[model samples]
Target: MKALNATLPTQGLLNFKNLVYLDLSFSTLHNNFLKDIGKISSLKILLLSGCQLSGTIPAAKGLCELKHLLKLDMSNNDLRGTLPSCLANLTSLQQLDISSNHFIGNISISPLGTLTSLHKLQLSRNLFKIPISLLPFFNHSKLKFLDCHENEIYADIDVPNLTPKFQLETLDLSGQGDGGVFPKFLDYQHKLEYVDLSDIKMKGEFPHWLIGNNTKLYTLHLPSCSLSGPLHLPMHSHVYLSHLDISDNSFNSPIPTEIGVQFPNLYFLNLSGNGLIGDIPSSFGKMSQLIKLDLSNNRLSGIIPQDLIVGCISLFNLILSNNNLQGQIFPEQANCKELDRLLLDGNQFTGSIPYSILNCTLLNMLDVSDNHLFGSIPGWIRNMTFLRVLDISENKFSGTLPSNFVPPQIREVYLSNNRLQGPLTNAFYNCSELMTLDLSRNYFTRRIPDWFGKFPKLSYLLLGYNNLVGEIPIQLCNLGQLSLVDLSNNNLSGHVLPCITAASNKVRQEEVGTNPYMASSPAYMKQPLEFTTKSISYYFQGSILKYISGLDLSCNNLTV
Candidate 1:
C-alpha cells in the first residue's frame, strides 16, 4: 500500500475485513487512520512502527476487535499512554512489541497469566514506573521472550521464587535495584542464554554457576554490580561463549590464563574499570574471533603479550588505559592488520610509537598520552590518512613537529607538555574539521600560525607556556566559533585584540557537562582542561569545558 503520506485515505480499509496483513510502518500517519484500521478483524499481522503517530494509542476501544492478531508491532512512534490491560483480550497474540514510546503510569493491570498463547512480548524504553519482577507468570508455557528493560520498572521488588515453566533464551534486567542473590530459578533453565544483568547490584560472590553449570550461557553482562571479593575463573573448557563484560566492580584478581582455553570464540570482552591486578593473561592470544578487547582503568601491570597480536588476527579495538603497565609497545602490533582504535593512555608505557603503526593504515583513534615515552615525534604520523584523534601528550618527546602534521579528517590533537621546539607548523590549517587543539607547555618558537583564523570548527586553542614570540595574531579574532583561548606564560608582546576578548566573552553557560565525543573529561586531556586563577587551576567538561573563556596572556610582554 502507498501509505507514505498522512493524506492516504483509510476509509476503504474499514470495509476490508479479509485483509490478513497490514503494515503502515515508516510513513507519515495520523490517529484517524489508526482508528479506521481497528475495524479489520482479520488482521493477523499489524505493524505501525515509526509512523509518527502522536498522542496515545486509543485504549480498549477499536483495536480490541483484532482478536486474531498474531503479531502486532507499534514501536518507534510518539504514542504515549498507560498500560492497556485490554491487550489481554488478544489471546492469539504470539508477538506484541510497543517499545520506544512515551508510555507512562503504573502497569498494575497487566493481564499476565491470562494470555496463554502470548509468546514474545516487548515493552522496552518506555516511561512506565512499575516493578519488572512481576512481568512473567509461571503457567505461561508458550512465552519464550519477555523484555521490559529501561522503563524505570525495577525499583524495589522481589522476583518470584517459583520455577519458570518456559525455557527463556534471553532475559535482560539491566539497571535494576538490589537483587539479594542470583535468581536460583534460572539454575534450572539450561536453555538460558544471552542474559544481561548489568548495573544490578547484588550481595554475595559472583554467580559461578552461570558458567560452570549452564555451559550454554553465551552472552552475559554483569557490569556495575558493585559485587565484592576476588574473581573466580570459570572451569568450563568446552563452552562457546562469545561475549562477556563484568566490568566496573571490585573483582580483585589476576586475569586467568584459562580464558583462551575456554572461550576461544570470544568476539567481545570488556573487563575494564575494575580492581583487576596482575598481568593480562596470554590466553587472550587464542581469541582469533575477538573483535574488541577493553581492559582499561584497572591495576593491570606488565606488557601486552605479543601473542595477542598474532592470535587475535581480527582484533580491531584495543583499549588498555589507566593501568600500571610498564614496557615499550611491540612493533608487531601492526601484524594485527585489522586493528583500528588503540588507547594505551594513563600508563607507564615507555619508548617511541612503533614505526609498525604505519602498517596499520586503517587506524582511526590512537591515544598514548600520560606515558613515559621519550623520543622525537614521528613524522610518518601524517601518512595515516584515516587517523582522526591523536593524543601523545605528557611525554618527554623533543623535536620539531613534522610539516603537514595534521591529517585531513583529524578532529582532535593533543601534543601538550612535551619538550618539542620549533615553529608552530601550519599543518593545523589542513584540519578543517578540527574541534580541539592543545600544544601548551612546550618550547615551540616562532609566531603562532595565522591560518588558525580560517578554521570553521575550531573551539579550543591552547598554546600556553611557550617561547612563541610576536604580536597576538589578530587574525585569530576571525574565528567566530572560537570559544577557549589560552595563550598565557609566553613571550607574546602585542595589544590584546578586542575581538579575542569578545569571542571569550561568549561563555557557553556556567556548567561542567559531558562531552559527546569522549567517554569523560579525563579521556579528552591528560588532566582536566584547566583555567588558572590566582595560582589555582579549575577544570571544566562538555561543550562548555572552556565555556567561561578568557585570554590568559599572563606573564607575557603584552600591552593593554
Candidate 2:
C-alpha cells in the first residue's frame, strides 16, 4: 500500500468522498493502479480508456468495494487483457464500452450471463474473432443497443432468440466479413428501428422480413453484400420508410410500379447501376416529399410522365438518362418550380420545343438533344436568365435567328444538326459568358458578328456548312481564347478571312456548306428574287426552307 501511494502523482490524489465520475482515460496508467483503485469506494463511473494500459485485468478478489459503479468505458486503450472471470462480480454495472482495445483472450460466456442489468454493450473495432457465444444469456434481456461492427468475430445470426430483448432497437453487425445466406433472422424484430448489415457476405436474395409491413424499421442499408435476384415486393407495406439505398447489387426486374404505394414516406430512392427496367411508375408522383430520384443506367423505357414533375414539387435532382424512352417532352413548368436539373437526352422525341420551359426559374441545366423536334425556338427560352447549359441540337428547327436568343448565363449551347436560317443574330455577341457554341449544320448567312472577339470566355465555335459570305469577321480572328473553329465549305471570300485555315493554331477546318439546290450563284442574297424553278435538291420545298443540309445557301447573289 505504501509503494502504491508513492507512485501516485503528488498533486493527483483528491477527495474521494463525492467523486461520482473519475475519468483517467488516455493517462497511460499500468495494471498497478487497477488493484489500488479499490480504495475509491465511492466511485460510480470509471473511464480508463486508451491509457496504454497493458496486461490482463487483475484478479477481482480485492476490488469488490465498487458496488455502486454503474458505468465503465475502457475502450481504445492498450488494455491487452482478457475477460476476467471476476467481471461476474460487478453485477451492478449497467453500461460497458470495452471496444478498440487490445483485449486478447476467450470471451467466456459464463461470466457475462449474470450481467442481467447490462443495457448497452459496445465491443466493436477489436480483434475478437470468436463466434458470438452470448446467445444463451440474451433471452428475455434488457440489452437495447448492440454495436459489434468491424470486429473479426463470426457468428450465425439467430433472430428468434433475440426477440425477447424488448428494449433492443438498433443492431449493427456490419463489417464482420462473414459469408452465408442471411438467415431469416428478423421475423420478430417488431421494435427494431435501424439495421445496417452492409459489406458482410450475406448470399441469396434479401429476406423480405427486414422491411415488411409488420416491421417498424425506418433505415435499412444493405450494400455490397452479394445479395442477388429481383427484390420481391415486401408483402407488408413500409409506410414509415424514408431513406432506402440498395445500390451496387445484382437485383434485376422492373421496379414494382406499386413502390410509391408501398413506401409512401420514401424521400431518397437510389436504385442506380441495377438491371431494373420498365417505365417509371406514374404513381411515384404520389410521393410528394421525395427529394432525389436516380433511375439512371437502367433498362427503363417509355416516356417520362409529366405528372412526376407536377407531383414531386420538391424534387431537386432527376436523372433518367441512358434509357430507351421515346416521347416529346411535356411542356409544363408550373408544377416543377424547384426543378434545378432536367437530363432527358439519348431518346427520340418529336415536335417543336415547348415554350413553357421558361417558367422553370430555377433551372440550371436543360438537355433535350438527340430528339426529333422542329420549328423556330421560342424567344422565351433564352430569357431563362438562370440557365447555365442549353442543348437542343440534333433536331429540326428553323426560322430567322431570334434576337436575344442567347442567355448571358448560358455557358454551353449545342444547337448543331438543326435547320435554323438567317444571318447571325447580333444578340449572340452579348453572351459574354459563352464557352462553347456549336451551331454547325445551320443556314447562317452574311458576315459573322463583328463583336465575336469581345467574348472573353468563347473557346469553341463550330459554324460549319453555312452560306456565310462577305468574309469571316476580322474580330473573330482576334479572339485569343478561341481554340476550335470549323468554317469549311462556306462561300466565304475576302482573303479567306486571314488566320482562318486548317493550319491556324486554334482553328480546325472541315468540309461544310452543302447546297440543297444546284445553282451557279452562292446563297446569302440580300435582294428577294422569284424562283423560276426549284433547285435540283429542292432547298425551297417547305415554308421558307432555304437553309437545308447544314446550310443550303446556294443560287443567290452573295459576295465576299
Candidate 3:
C-alpha cells in the first residue's frame, strides 16, 4: 500500500498469520509500526521503501526474527545507523536492498557475509566503508548482482588476491573506493554485463582486455577515473556493447578508427573532456542506432564528417563544442529528424547557419556562439515551437533580427556581440515564459521597452553596449523575479529607480521542475551565461546562476 495516510496498527498486522508478502512502500506509518511485525514469522517478502522511516533498525525481535524472509527492501528512506548484526539470522534471504539511506559501518563486519543465499544486494549511497577488494563476499558463489556505489569504500593495498567464488552479472562501485589500481578480481569476472567505476581514482591505461574477456558487456562507464593513454578497444567486435562513457579522463590520443565497427549497436557514447586529437572517424557513420553523441572539450581537429551527420538518423543530442573543428556547420544533405539539442560553440567553424538543420523540428536548444559564422539571423528559427534556448552570440552575424524572431516557448535568448543593427522589435512581447534575454554589444538603437515588465518569469535582462538613448524606465521594477540587470555602456539619462534596486535584492528562486524542455543529460546546458560586474566578467550557470544578484549601469549617461 502507498500514500495510505492512515496509520497501520501493529495489532491489526499481527492478525495475518500466513502473510507471505507485505509492501508498505511510500506510506505514512507510525514510528512503532514494525514493533510487533516480527510476530508474523511467515513473512517471506517485506518492502518498506520510501516510507520516510528514520533512526536505527528496530531491536532483534522486530525484524531479525523473520527467518523465513527471502526478500527485504527498505530503500529510499531516511533510515540511519548500522545494520543490525542479528540480520544474519535471515539465512533464506535472496535479495537485500537498503540503498539511498544513511546506514553506516563496515560491510565485512555486517550480517551480509553470512547471507550465502543472497543473489542480489544494493547498499549504494550510504556511509559504509567497505574494502575495495570485496573479501567478505568471496565465498558467496550464488551472488550475481552487487551495487555499492557512492559510499566510503576504500582500497586496501595489503589485501591478498583471493579469487571470488561468484561471477557477477552487474557490478556498480562507482563514486566510491580510494585512489589505487583497478580491482584485480575483475580479471576473472567473465560473466559481467554492466560495470561502472566512475569517480574512482584508479590511475592506469584503458583496460582493453576487460572488453575482450567480458564479451557480453553492454554498458561500461569509467569517467573521472584518472585513466591515461590511448583508449584501446579489443580487436574483435563487441556486438552487444551499447552505452560507453570515458569522459573527464587523461586519454591523450586519437579515437580508435574502428570504434563504430567494434560497437556498432551503441546507443549512447561520450568521450568528452579528454586530450584526444585528430579527425572524428568516418566509421562513426556505421552506427545507425546511435542516439546521444558527445565529443566536446577535446583537441579534435578537421571538419565534422558528413556521413556521421546523415547516417545517424536516430540522433537526439549532439555536442561537439570547444574543439578545433572547422568548416561549415553541416552538409546540405544532413537530415537528423530526431535531433533535439545541438551545441557547436567555441569552435573554428565558418559559414552561415545552414538550412539543413531545419529537418530537426524538435530542437530544444541550439548553440553556435564564439564562431566565425556570418549572415543574417534566420527567420525560420521561429518555426521551432519546442525551442527553449537559442545562443548565437560572439559571431560575425550582421543585419536586423527577423521581425518574427522569437519562438513561442523560448526561455533564454543570447544574441550578444554581433553586428546586428536596428530598433528592438516587439517580437518578444508575447513571450511570457522568457527567463533570460541578452542583446549586448550590438548597434541596436531605441528606448528600453516598457513591455519587458510584462514577462512574469524574466530573471536576467542584459542590453549593454548599444547605441540606444533614453531614460531608464521605472516599469522594470514590476519584474519580481529580476536578479541581474545590465544597461551599461548606453546613453541613458535618468535617476536610478529605487524599486529596481529593491527588486534586485530579492532572492531569485528557480523554477526547478517546471522546465518542459529539460534534457536527459546536464551536458545539454553546459554553456554559461556571461555578465560583467566591477569591471570583471563572471560566468553563471546551473545552481550558481540563481544565487547571483547584481545591477550594472556603468559607462552610461545616467544621472543621480
Candidate 4:
C-alpha cells in the first residue's frame, strides 16, 4: 500500500469520520505527519509502520485527540524527535509500538503508565537514552509486555524493593537488561512466559529459579550471558517451552539424558559453544516435535545414536560441528523428512557417507568435512534433488568423481585436503549454481577444467596443491564472479591469462556485484578463503572474505 511522496492529506481522511481503524503500513508514504491527523477521532487502530513517515512528532495534537485509540504502530519509519507530550493523553491506548525509528531524547516511562490500559510497549532499536529509574514508572498493573532491547537505557535500579505489579507475558531485555545481573524482581513475576536475558553477564549456575518459579515459558534465550555450571532443567518447569538458547557460555556438563523427557514440546534448542561432553543423549529422540537442534562447538564425543533423532521427524536443522563426536553418520536421521541443514563437520566422525541419508530428499545443506570419514564418494548423493551445499573435505576419502558427483543445486563444494585421486570430470560442468569449489591439497591429476571459467556463479576456485600438470586453462578468465583462485604447488605450466592476473590486483567490476549472491549463507559462512599472501597461505573467514580476493599460482611448474 504505497502512498504519495507528498505530505499525507489528513484532510483526505477527515471524510472518513467514522473510521475505527486506519492502516497505511508499508505504503512508502513520505513527508512530515500532519498535526491535523488528530481529526480522526474514531480511530481505534492506526498502523503507519514502514510508511517512510519522517520528521518530528512535535505536535501530535490531532493524534492525541484519539483518546479511544486501542493500538498504534508507527515502527520502521524515519520519525524523529522526542515523543509528543500529548501522547500520554491516549488513556485508552492498549498497544503502542514506536520502535525501529530515529526517535531520541529522554523518554519518561511514567507518563505512558498513566494509560493503565496500555498492555504492550515496544521501544527497541531506537536512540532513546534515559534513567534506569524510569523503569519503575512502568509498574502499571495492566502492562503485560515491554521490549526495550538494543537501546541505551542505563541501569540504576532498586532491585530488592521494586516488585513489578504487572504479570508480564513477554519481556525481552536482552542487551538492554541495564543491570549486569538478572533482575531479581522478575523472580516475583510468576506469569512471565517469554524471557530473554542474553548478554546480561550473569555468573554461576543457570537461572533455574526463573523457570522453576514461573508457571511456564515459551521461549528463553540466554546466549552470551556468561553463566556457567551444569545445565539442569527442572522437570516440572517449562512443559511448554518451545525455544531455548544458551549458546556461547562456559557450560561444562553432560547434556542431561532426560532433556527430551523434560522438554518434550521443545521445537528449538541450542546449547552450542560450551564444554559439554559425552554422547548426545539418546533420550533426545523423545522430543518428537523438535525442529531445530544445535549442539555445535563443544567437546561432545561418542557416536550419535542413529535413533537419537529418529523420533524427531519434524527436525529441519541438526548442527553438531566442531565437536569430538565419533562413529558413522546415522542412517536413522533419514526419518526426518524435513531435514534441510545438517552440519557434522570438524568432528571425529568416521565411516563412509551413510547411503540411508539419501532417504532425506529435502536435504539442502550437508557438511561432513574435517572428519575421519573415508571411502569412495557415494553416487546416490545425486538422488538428493535439493542438496545445495556439500562439504566432504579434509578427510581420507579415496576415490574418483562419480559420473554425477556434483548435485545440480549445489552452491558450494568443499572436497579439499583429501586423499581422493581423480581427474577433472565434466559431469558437474553444467552445475550452474556451483560457486565455491575447493578440491585443493589432493592427488587430483589433470589439466584445469575449462568449465571452471563457465560456472556463472563460481567465486572461489581452489584447486591448489594438486598433482595436476598442464597450462592454466585460459577459460578461467570467463568466470565473471571469480574472486579467490588458488593454483599454487601444482605441476601446471602456462602463460597466465592477463584477466586472471588482474583478479588479484583489482576486483573485476562484474565480480564485485556477483559475490554476495553467489553462495547463500550458513554454507558460505565460516568457509575459509585460503590464498598465498607473501608466500604464506593466509586464511580469511566470515565477512572478512567478502573483501579479500586473491590468486595463488606460486610453486607450480607453470610460468606466467
> Which candidate comes out best when scored by lDDT?
3
1-560: candidate 1 lDDT, tens digit per residue: 55586555567777987999988788776677656677898899998888887786566766666889899898998888775677678899888888889988765556645777868878788886545444445666887777767766443365555776777777776755665555666676677677887877766566766776667778889898777777776766745688999889888888777778888888899989887899888888889999999999999999988788778888899989999998886545546678888888899989888887787778888888899999888778889998878888888899898877768778778888889999977667677777778899999998988888777767778898899999988788777767778888889997889888888777464434443322223344333466665667667655445445665768789887
Better of 3 and 4 by lDDT: 3
Candidate 4 Cα RMSD (Å):
3.5
Of candidates 4 and 1, the better by lDDT: 4
TM-score, every prediction: 0.86, 0.61, 0.90, 0.87
Screening candidate 3 with a backbone cut-off below 3 angstroms (N, C-alpha, C), the clashing residue pairs are: none
* Model 2 lowest lDDT segment of ten: 524-533
Query: Residue 47 of candidate 3: its Cα lDDT?
Result: 94
Lowest summed-lDDT stretch of 10 residues in model 1? 515-524
Question: Which candidate model has the greater lDDT, 1 or 3?
Answer: 3
- Which 10-residue window of candidate 4 scores lowest in summed lDDT? 130-139
Task: List candidate 3 segments past 4 Å from native.
Answer: 2-7, 15-18, 27-36, 58-60, 425-432, 449-456, 473-481, 494-502, 505-527
Give the alpha carbon lDDT tens digit for every residue of 92-184 in model 3. Answer: 999999999999998889888999999999999999988877889998999999999999767775877589999999998898556587788
lDDT, residue 324, candidate 4: 93
| lDDT of candidate 2 over 1-560, digit per residue (tens) | 21231223513444466677887766666567776776776778988776665666677742445777799887886666567677777878888898887766534343555677877777777665534333434542777777767765455554344444434577766776664666343554667777767677667886666677346777777776778898776876787777777765777778888787788788787776676777888888888888778776677788778768778877776767566777666545447767777777666667776666666778878877777778888878777888877788778888877787767767777787788888876757578777567777788777777887877666556676677776667777665545455565567665554444422443222222332111222232211112222333221222232322122223333343
